[model samples]
Target: MFRLAAAAACALALGLAAAPAPTSAAERLTLTSQYGPGKPQTLLWERFAEILERERPGAYDINIVTNGALGGEKEEAEAIRLGAITGAESTIANLTTWVPLGAVLDLPFVFQDAAHIERVLEGPLGDELKAAYRAEGFETPAFIIFGARHLLGKTPLTEPGDVDGLTMRVLQSDLHVALWRSLGANPTALPITEAYTALSNGVVDAMDMTKSGFEALKLYEVAPVLTETAHIWAVGVVYFDANFWAGLDADERALFQKASEEAAAYFNEIAAEEQEAALQRAMALGASRAAVDQELWRAAVAPFVEDFVRNMEDPRAVDALEMIQEAR
Candidate 1:
């Protein structure tokens, strides 16, 4: 009888211990990044979640999903808009589907260097861009750097002429198509997932990508050549769902914004360090590196830039371009 009573007492103790403790009202948010684990983009979101939880204590809990577990950027973006998910990361180029002016960031040669890109995105130009996102129902525009995009090709790109007649993979943005076409390459729009197979099988001859992307996708094994074109300052922006954001109090919003800003600055530093490492890794894997003929490539693409600017319907496009150029 004593053993039976002791067992009953121990069962009661275990039950109580297994039950969750009572806590204050807490909101749960889901944040997703498409990048795989250990990539800077994935790590940045992880740190952001940590900051949010630390700031709010039991008031909020943020769950992060990495490696496109939810979906690719576009699919995740649509989900966020419908309030299916709380938030996701996106490139300015990809955001063009919602905000046409987002293409301004993807235009080649607009940013002279990383510093110039940073200044524009952190200044009035960025303010305008953020306002556009907010107007369209996204909130807290946080910029994430993916480093400078370079040419990854099956053959060496010694001059602008080398790209002529070669089929190159491009993003799903019209501007990318126009840019590559202007360079005399036939631009093919392929989802990044298919790029490795396409390159290895000779379906496409070249692609424009960042060191981080090249390394992450292991495309060097197929392409084997990295040209330092640094054509555009590749960037991705993170925005929250408008409904979810509006539900948050001012303090909550401020806390998130602060965390995003600090995290972006931190990410840029890490990207700089990773850039050298990615280059070394690619070279060690038997990839050849080459210098681009910038002047020649710029001269070839100048007409396209002018035509693009002349066709902008929004006057804000002119102002944005001016601000970007002055930063250089």
Candidate 2:
């Protein structure tokens, strides 16, 4: 009787000591962005990390890589595609490589304000774009507002005619190139990292960038004239590789989704404030600000829009343009 009891006790002790096969370590999630630490985007992601931890404790540990430490925008995007990186915050232009429909967001003068942009992106159009990203092996968690684009140049650009014959640096997007060319400028596509040198060396005379971007990059030091063209409102997308997203548990996924939505909204608010502050900083630094002649600029670039509509193979491009016009 005592032997059997001892055996039973041993079994019970072993069962208890086994510790339920030891729960696996949480999956690691890494998020990369070109912006430096302490930037609004980084702070937004930091909050996202807190949300993930609180909502899905022990399920995920998020690591944020900032300041292009992994790579510049394009390289970071390519890394996500190859699964070398799990997540990133990149411009719609970068996402266009996976989904051509993304280029639709870059249509110049499409959105007048943040509210208009929010309505379009948070509505059916945004959902459709998200679905397209899913089909392309990505999970677009949220789209963050990047604020309105402005013109920064060595020479004043009050109208489209002023842009003529000027070599302007543009994002490495075909649409951006087309837009600048349409305005009569010699557009050169370069990565944001190279833009500072390009402007300093006179390789490019002007560029269309966000006010915050201009201040952050210190481009105002080189380009003293900042024009409020407000041609297009830009957005940044936070996304994860589909394979990585799929590996996340239900609770983890929910956490990410919720966190992203909240972060995006917060980012929009911060972006607006930063844009105004950047403008003030630029002005303080001796940069001049001028109002652009929208009518003249529109007339000069009308041909380019017509050409794009006529020759562009992507039907979504036309649809997006029509949608923006209707919204206006």
TM-score of each predicted structure versus truth: 0.88, 0.87
Clashes of each: 0, 0
**Ten contiguous residues with the weakest lDDT in model 1:** 10-19
lDDT of 2 by residue, 1-328 (tens): 6334444543453334332332568676667666777777787888888877777676765667676665567766666655666787778877676677777777776677888777778777788889988888788989988988889998678887788899999887778888888768999988788888999999999998898888888889999888988877787788888888888778768877899888877878888899989888878988878887777766766777667766666677677667766665
Give lDDT per model, in order: 0.77, 0.78
lDDT of 1 by residue, 149-220 (tens): 999987788687888999998887778888888878999886676788889999999998898788888899
- Model 1, runs deviating above 4 Å: 1-26
Residue pairs in collision within model 1: none
Q: TM-score of predicted model 2?
A: 0.87
